[model samples]
Target: MSPRILILGGGYVGMYTALRLQRKLRRGEARVTVIDADSYMTYQPFLPEAAAGNLEPRHVVVPLRRVLNRCTLLSGWATAIDVAGRTVDFSPHRGESRKIEYDVLIVAPGSVSRTLPIPGLAECGIGFKTVEEAIHLRNHVLAQLELAASTTDQAVRREALTFVFVGAGFAGVEALAELEDMAHDALRYYPELKADELRWYLIEATDRILPEVGPEMGRWTLEQLRARGIDVRLGTKLESAKDGRIVLDDGTEFDAATLVWTAGVKPHPIVRHSDLPIDAKGRVKATSRLTVEGVDGVFAAGDCAAVPDLTNPGEYTAPNAQHAVRQTKVLADNVLAHLRGGKMGDYRHAYAGSVASLGLHKGVAQIYGRRLRGPLAWFVHRTYHLSRVPTVNRKVRVLIDWTLALFFRREIVALGALSEPRREFELATRDK
Candidate 1:
């Protein structure tokens, strides 16, 4: 019988690793299967654009089943991993639990939003991680304009016009910038709402933002955001937002309709459930070879694994797409070598650089020790991400989206009705 390989999570690591393995391994050498909660892999960097309606949500995500043709695609969650028993207990979308035995296991269940125990945050804050959040945010933002236009209450309008975003990392900054741009453009359609009436606040606990782009670029980004009328507050913490009333640690308080939390992410909860050796940060401890320490035949990578960075000693690889995507090749090779008794390779890559988008025509990038800002950086951001999105179909779709966008005005129409498709039916049924 051929060896059965089970891969958890369908993020960059899981998808790319499976893609590579299917080509490298001969038929009958191994059977591969991937199980994920969602059937698509989100190119997370585009969540901001998706939220802003700059790109269709469908184009940013790669459908896993269509791409992983040779591998079994299971749309489910891996509830448990039996390390000693050599089996994985999985729960399907609709069915009884089942156990699958595998000769090799790959754990790459990506991270989830790392949240703090702040009051009201649970109810008021939305994350910019998945495509669903992006869609919901877009709908909500447009809905707010509708609410403000139709209302005469100053308090209600004030609340709807105020936007607050916590955590100024790449996700937070880009999302805020893009969404802000959308809102700014959207205001042109709302005669009652003036651009000056909208208020945006970006609250960060640290002294700087976008640390991945280095100090100079980070500072420049802050200045740019401030210049765009975003209230950039450094060394500030969100006190609370219970009942949609914003309160800050610096003794400031206000009402806001939108609060986005993009602080960071923690390892997927499944890692803690497994009996793997974890580090202080709750990440699976992995060697430079990408093997989970002390777990035979089990490998971990991506945002969940604490893989040692050979080039940068004394530190694990940063949880970024650049490292995560690069690590997958080495990880797939190592897994294949382990199965075939071949030599394994270590995962090592120096920090190349970083890129961030500030709205549509503005950006910052630091590549190979060169710093670039403004329109060139923005163009590079688009060009690089377009190339990185998986599948020729999706790349073409995204490029078409951009091409069409260039020839036409921005599509600012809000289809909030999409979120609650059944509401009208329910109301009709009740009336009858």
Candidate 2:
């Protein structure tokens, strides 16, 4: 009988591994099955643009069934992994629990939003992860302007116009810049809303933002943000956010309806529940080749696994898309080698710098030991990401969006009803 291979969480690692195995391994060698909560793999780097109406939300995600045709695709969430019994317990899209036995397992369940205990955050704030959140934020930001313009109440207008973004990382910085640009362009249509009326504040507990791009580039980014009238509050923390009142640790207080939390991410909670060896940071501990330590016939990778960074001594790789994509190639190769009884190579790659977009026609980038800023950097950022955006079909669509954006104004329509799909249903039911 052929050994059954079960790969969990169809993110970068899971999908790539399955695809490679399907191509490398023979039909009777191993039967590969991949399971994920969602059938689509979100290309997260494009999320800020997607949120800013620069790109379509559907284009940012790749359908798993279309890509992984050779492997068996299961739409569900893995609840538990019984390594001892070689069985995984999972819950389907809308069904009861089911268990599947596997001779080999790959646990690559990715990270989730690492929320803090800040007051009212759970109820008020929205995170900048996934396609749903990006679409919701895009609609919400546009709708805020509409609400402010239609209302005559001063307090309501002030509350609706103010926007707060927490965290100074790539997500926070890109999201704030893109949304700010969108809102500014949208205000030309609203006579009552002025650029000054919209308060854009970015709070970061750290002293500097964009640490990935080095200090010089980070400093330049700070200046660009400030020049745009954005309040870049460094070394400040969000102490509380209750009833739309935001309190900073530095004793600043403000009332804002939209609070976006792009603060870091933690390993998915499902990893903790599994009987796998985990690191101090709650990540699955894997060898340099991406195989789970002390677990036979099991491997892991991506944001959820602490794969050793062979290039950097005494440190595991940082969780980022750049590293994830590069690591996935090695992970796939190593998994196939292990199955074929060939020698597996260790994963190692040097840091290749970072790039970040600050709204339209502006960006900061550090690549191959060179620093670039302004329009050149923005162009480089777009060019680099466009080339690396996975499939050729998505690349063409994104390039077309960019081409069209050059000739026309951004789409400012806000479909806020998307967040509450059941609102119309509830209204219709009540009317009946």
Candidate 3:
């Protein structure tokens, strides 16, 4: 009988691993099944562009059903993993929970936003992790602009137009920059609004932003943002956000309708369900070969696995797409070797630096010790991610979107009603 291979999460690791196995596995060599809550895998790097109206939201996500045709696709969440029993508890989108047993398990559920217990944060703050959040943010920002334009109350207008982003990582910096540019361009439509009236703030707890690009490039990026009139508060932290009232640890307080949190991430909470060996940081322990440490016939990678860094030694690979995407190649190969009684290879790739987009035609990058900025870096950023976006279908669609953007103006239409499509219908049905 062929062994059953069950994969959790359809993000970078799970999807790519299943895709590789589908192509290499002999007929009926193994039964591969992928489980994820969402039916599509979001290309997260393009999320900023999607939010800023540079790319359509649909083009940024790859439909799992269309790509993984040979693998069994289950739309659900893994409630628990009984490692010893070799079974996982799963709850589908519209069904009761059940147990799924597999001969080999691949845990790659990925990570979730790392949030804090700051007051009012849960009620007022938004995250930038998924495509849904990206679109919602775009609409919300534009809606805020509309509100400010119509309001005569100065306090209300100030609060509505103020935007605060905490944590200066790639997500925070890129999202803020893109949306700021879009909003600035949109001011021409609102005769009552001025560009300087829209306030943007980037607050980071640490002393630096984009630490991946090294200290030198980080400083340059900081200066560039400041030159564009963005108030960057480094070495600071968010104290409270109760009711849109932002309180910083450095004795600053303000009200903002939009507060974006991109601080960091933690491994998916599902890891606790299994008895797998984990690191101090709650990530599944993994060796250089991508297999779960001390576990037989099981593997893990991506943001959830703490795979030791061989090149740097004494450190684990940083949880990012560059590493996650590359790790899948070695992971798929090693999985097949383990299943077919062949030799397993180790996963090793030196840090390739990082690239970031600071709105259209502006970017910063450090690759192979070579630093670039401005249009050249921006072009390189788009080119590199386009090459890695997976599937020619998505690549072509995204490229077409970029081409059209050059000849067209950005769409600032706020579809806030999409969030509550049935509200108007329900109201109409009620007696007046």
Candidate lDDT scores, in order, read: 0.92, 0.90, 0.94
Q: What tens-digit string does per-residue lDDT give for candidate 3 at 1-432?
A: 899999999999999999999999999899999999999999999999999999999999999999999999999999899889999999999969999999999999999999999999999999999999999999999999999999999999999999999989999999999999999889989999998898899999999999999899999999999998899999999999999999999999999999999999999999977899988899999999989988898999999999999998899999999999999999999889998899999889998889999999999999999999999999999999999999999999999999999999988799999889899999998957
lDDT of 1 by residue, 145-235 (tens): 8999989999999999999999999999999999899999888889998888889999999999999999999999999999889998899
Worst 10 residues of 3 by lDDT: 272-281
Estimate, for each residue in 11-83, the C-alpha lDDT of model 2 and write its tens digit: 8778777877888887688898998999988888899999999998888888899888888889988888888
Best by lDDT: 3
Deviation of model 2 at 263, angstroms: 1.1
Ranked by lDDT, top first: 3, 1, 2
Question: Higher lDDT: candidate 2 or 3?
Answer: 3
- Winner of 1 and 3 under lDDT: 3
Shift in Å, residue 204, candidate 1? 0.6
What are the TM-scores, per candidate, against the unseen true structure?
0.99, 0.98, 0.99
